[model samples]
Target chain A: MQKADALVPVSAYVARAALGRLAAEGSVKVSETEPDWAALVIRVRDHGDTQAFAALFRHFAPRVKAFLMKSGAGAALAEECAQDVMATLWQKAHLFDPARASVATWVFTIARNRRIDTLRKARRPEPEDLPWGPEPEPDQADAFELAEDTRRLGEALAQLPEKQRALIERAYFGDLSHTEIAAETGLPLGTIKSRIRLALDRLRQSMT
Target chain B: MTIRHHLTDALLMAYSAGQLPEAFSLVAATHISLCDECRARLSAFDAVGGTLIEDCDPAAMDEDSLTATLARLTGAPARPRQVDRPARGLFPAPLRDYVGGDLAAVKWRPVGLGVRQAILPTAPGGVARLLYIPAGQAVPDHGHRGTELTLVLQGAFRDESDRFGPGDLEVADQGVEHTPVAEADADCICLAATDAPLRFNSLLPRLAQPFLRM
Candidate 1:
């Protein structure tokens, strides 16, 4: 009886894995209503389309400024840094990998690096780039699913208890040290972590 | 190479948040360069950062900010997409960049025993160094005052708890004390970072600690 019970969960997990693979291969239709943040970046990269860049700037620049301000920059400095961050976004559009990260994630990384450079004056060593997939054109399904995953992650963050949510916000805002983060409230990171893991697995599959 | 141990979630989160000291960031970056698991995990934390940024209350930019940014973008060229290399040498790219090249680039100074170390330049509040332990040699026994992160770059080492091979990271804290010995077959090279000075158990190493900065 115990053997049967174990087999049931194993089979279910296998089924789920297969379904995920099928979805990643573009068999499943992602809703068309979902915003295609990658498309704007592609326009900026390939055509230097100011309209597309303007759209991205209008959405992300203010948030980037807010992020810098929270990290201890004065208003004028935050404004200047936010502009620099957006200008960098325009110049580094080619480096953005939609299949690997959502637009917001890419923008956040760029902003975070700028904050470090301007605020801390410290070097941030980045991981070596993994050899991307042989496909020159990113698969639309992969990009869509990754964006959707990040959107869901934002929702999950919103649903966490106030204390846990605040802790997470503080960590990102540069207020918490690793030791303090570890000692503080137990963040319910499992859901978001697993969701991101799923996105990574899809990208890894596409890479190979 | 198979990696057994990995960075803790707290470390990865701090790194993604850009809150870690530069020395620890160097160690974390070098380890992530070698370990794909941590790379994926780091991306997860970055995604959390993205979510936080998205949910932030907007602090409106000056009305001319977008126009000013676009003006700056007119003459600037986008950086060419980085081409991926097929194979890597002993040190990953981050460590290589720090050292200016591969294994040949490091300037080693003896720190007692057969071990040698070269401190990497980073901002204050922590220290990062490359450690070389001769085959079958033992590093001085030490306990951590804060956190100590050691990542194997080449060969393997065995401490009181377990073995660490290339790409493995051991995160030791204040509560732990151990002497790590290089495996007999090959010399071991590692990147280690600590926020506070290590507590050396032996008097000789203790005396030399200030000069060596370990």
Candidate 2:
């Protein structure tokens, strides 16, 4: 079988998470509300829960700001972008489907796309379909699976070989394409692609 | 349809990071809608993106930013969003938004050799179009000057590399060259995007390129 074909069963994933190396930290952790963030966001939407919204903002805003800064945004612009992301969350809270996306994925996707939108000087109308795109069929990552996957992602990422992990950050966060990464790092295109593929395999193995 | 061809991890990562042009992202998004596996994997990539954000060196924000955001929230009523669920048809949500309607509504202009095309208006310099090929028909043999994402929305097509069925996305670049022929059973409809013009091998196709605007 190809290396990429080694997708683990859910039991293996559970075993991996139970080992504690799999629980990754992030911007927010809901101690009182715990894992059901979809419900928490729903509370923010239905009842206008200030506490939940505030909690989300406090944890994510600084990180979103930092994210934009990494993508070469000025401090002032990054802050504005971060604020826009938070406002979008509040405004679009009803669209949060926990089954389809973890809170971390949903928030960061907003941050990533917002960075691009702000960078574009022209203000064009975005199609009804937002950046996250559509999720029609049921995904394999159920809420329980997503909770485990999100908790474990950081740990799995941390365990990657230094070079692989760094490349992943550049690819996912720095907004660099594989070819661009090769150019920046002075690595061959083939080398960068293979390293990233291997890194993703490890992440999938460790995440699953 | 069993999806055999898929966007490479590198391509998928580029799409997730917004490094790809809008045209490439549009094709990726449309294929992702129909392929549950790709959607699931993309979610993982998105989560990874979120983790990277948390790990960045903290950038200080405006002290009054939180105060401002909070103050604005109280005045702004909760905006309920009506998600536009694309009707179950040949066109998915992303494609529907560009086409402005269902598949039959497409205004296809001839692209020679029984192939029809409707170029969707997107950001300048990035070209995305819908292709219709009758069964057993073939796209002119060609390579790409830049990246091309060909997503099969209906039926199947085969190139030099492999066969692609519904929900399969073929990511092509300059180094790859092949003729993609639709399967015999049904006509093929694909959403394709290319950043640069194609490199057709034949003299006639190459000569006609300026006219096709491909």
**lDDT of model 1 at residue B106?**
94
lDDT of 1 at B137: 96
TM-score for each candidate, following the candidate numbering: 0.83, 0.73
DockQ of each: 0.27, 0.19
lDDT of 1 by residue, B1-214 (tens): 7889998888988899998888899889988877667777787788888888888898978866765776666543464554767456788888888898888889999988878999998876678889999999997654457889999998899998899999999999877868899999999999999875533224545675697554
Runs of candidate 2 with Cα error greater than 4 angstroms are A1-42, A121-145, A178-208, B74-87, B197-214
- lDDT tens string, model 1, A104-163? 888999999999998877889998776655555666776676676778778777888998
Compose the digit string of candidate 2's lDDT tens values, residues A1-208. 1111112222343343344333445434323434455565776776666555655665678888888887888898888888889888877776675555667678888887886677743122222343232332224345555556566666676777788778877786665654463323222223223333443344345433
Error of 2 at B40 (Å): 0.1
User: CA shift at B187, candidate 2, in angstroms?
Assistant: 2.6
Q: Local distance difference test, per candidate?
A: 0.79, 0.67
What fraction of the correct interface contacts does each predicted structure contain?
0.66, 0.38
Interface RMSD computed for candidate 1 is what? 11.7
